[model samples]
Structure formats: structure tokens, C-alpha cells
Target: MAYNFKNGRESVGDEPRSGRPVEARTDNNVQRVRTFEHQDRRITVRMLAYELNLKRETVRKILTDNLSMKKLYAKMVPSS
Candidate 1:
């Protein structure tokens, strides 16, 4: 057989990518989150997650890290 299973397999292809970031954390996703926040300046992280179909933590990361935004006094605003 071309690909042996007894001892070892013969396969030559691209290396597996286990350290790559998930699609949810890509730049495109960040931009999408930015757009949503722009529409509603007071949107909460939990609300954003629900609207964008992402996890609360992921949305928080996108908002704080990628977008440079923060929640202050129940408002999503740009952090200086």
C-alpha cells in the first residue's frame, strides 16, 4: 500500500498547523467587531458576543486589544 499503517505512513504534505490562531481572532474578525461597536457606542461585551456570534472573552479581547476600546461607566469608549 502507498500509505503503510503497520509501522509508519508515507505521506508528504504541508506541515500541520497547531499553533495558528483561530479564525475568530483574525484581523477580519476584529474589523467586524469594530464595525458593530461603531454602530452602538454603548454595547456591552456580552451583548457584542451575542450579536457577533462569538464568545464573551473573544469579544472582550477584540474590543480591548484590537480595537483599543474599554468599558467605562457602562459605556464602550475608546481608551486613551
Candidate 2:
């Protein structure tokens, strides 16, 4: 069985996301974020975001999730 919409708006592939797009998260960006954090533990999220041209949340995710780190007393350190 197949169901299709005759409207011109219909597309054959997945639609774009609802947000600003997923450019912030990438292998290169992740490595860059790690390098920046390693160079300065006290680097602020705002600074990282600005340097990488990514949103604060995206930078934070790279730090916490990708790097397994967390903010501790205004510093980024290992989660464990």
C-alpha cells in the first residue's frame, strides 16, 4: 500500500528540522571545542560560542556530552 499527497508541497525525502539547522555539531567542531577547553579550563560558554560561531547551547553540548565534561565553579572539568 502507498499513500501520497498530490499537493506540490509534498517532497520525496525528509523535511528540514524546525530549528536553525545542525551545523553546530560536527567532528571538526567537536575536536575544536575540546582543544579550546583544554587550553583554558575557565573559558566561558559565551566565549566558546563566539569563537566557534555556534550557539551557547551547542558549545555546551560539545563540552558536556562529546567531551564528557561539566562546568565546575566556572571551569570545564571532567565529569567523573
Candidate 3:
């Protein structure tokens, strides 16, 4: 039996043994979130995920990990 490092197990020449699960959102979500942030609305993580077509976790990571992105998101919120 040959070892398939790509996904573990044997490879059937070129076909995938199984299909991977699809993500709920696409790259378009990133654009949408940026747009919303520019509009000056307090975008919650959940709402942004739904409207932007991204997973809540993904959006959270993007906002937290990227400084520029976080800054852009911050601009959307109004000061209390």
C-alpha cells in the first residue's frame, strides 16, 4: 500500500478519495465587511459574518490578526 501524504491513505492515481467540506463564505465576504466598516455602522462579529459571507471565526481572526484591517473595522464604530 502506498502512503498518500496529501490527505493520508492511498491515492487512486489522481482522483480525490473524498470531497472536503465547503466553507460558508467566499472571498467576497472580505470585501463586504470592508464596505460595511466604511459605512460607519457598528459591525458585530456575527452580523459581519452573515452579511459578508464569512465564518464568524474567520472574521474574528482577520480583525484581530491584521492591524490595518482592525483599524478599518474600528473606524466603523461610533465613540460612546
lDDT of each model, Cα atoms only?
Answer: 0.82, 0.83, 0.58
Q: State the weakest 10-residue window (summed lDDT) of model 2.
A: 1-10
Candidate 1 residue pairs in backbone clash = none
Q: What is the C-alpha RMSD of each candidate to the true structure, in Å?
A: 6.0, 5.0, 6.9
How does model 1 fare in lDDT?
0.82
Candidate 3 lDDT by residue in tens digits, 1-80: 45466558554676645675455334555556667766645767788778766787877655554314443544323222
Best by lDDT: 2
29 Cα displacement, candidate 2 (Å)? 0.2
Model 1 poorest 10 in a row by lDDT: 1-10
Candidate 1 displacement at residue 26 in angstroms: 0.8
Tens-place lDDT per residue, model 2, 17-59, is 7976656789998999988877887789899999888889999
Candidate 2 collision pairs? none
Please report how far candidate 3 places residue 56 from its true position, in Å.
0.3
Runs in model 2 lying further than 4 Å from the true structure: 1-13, 16-23
Please identify which of the two predictions, 1 or 3, would achieve the higher lDDT against the true structure.
Answer: 1
Per-residue lDDT of 59 in model 1? 90
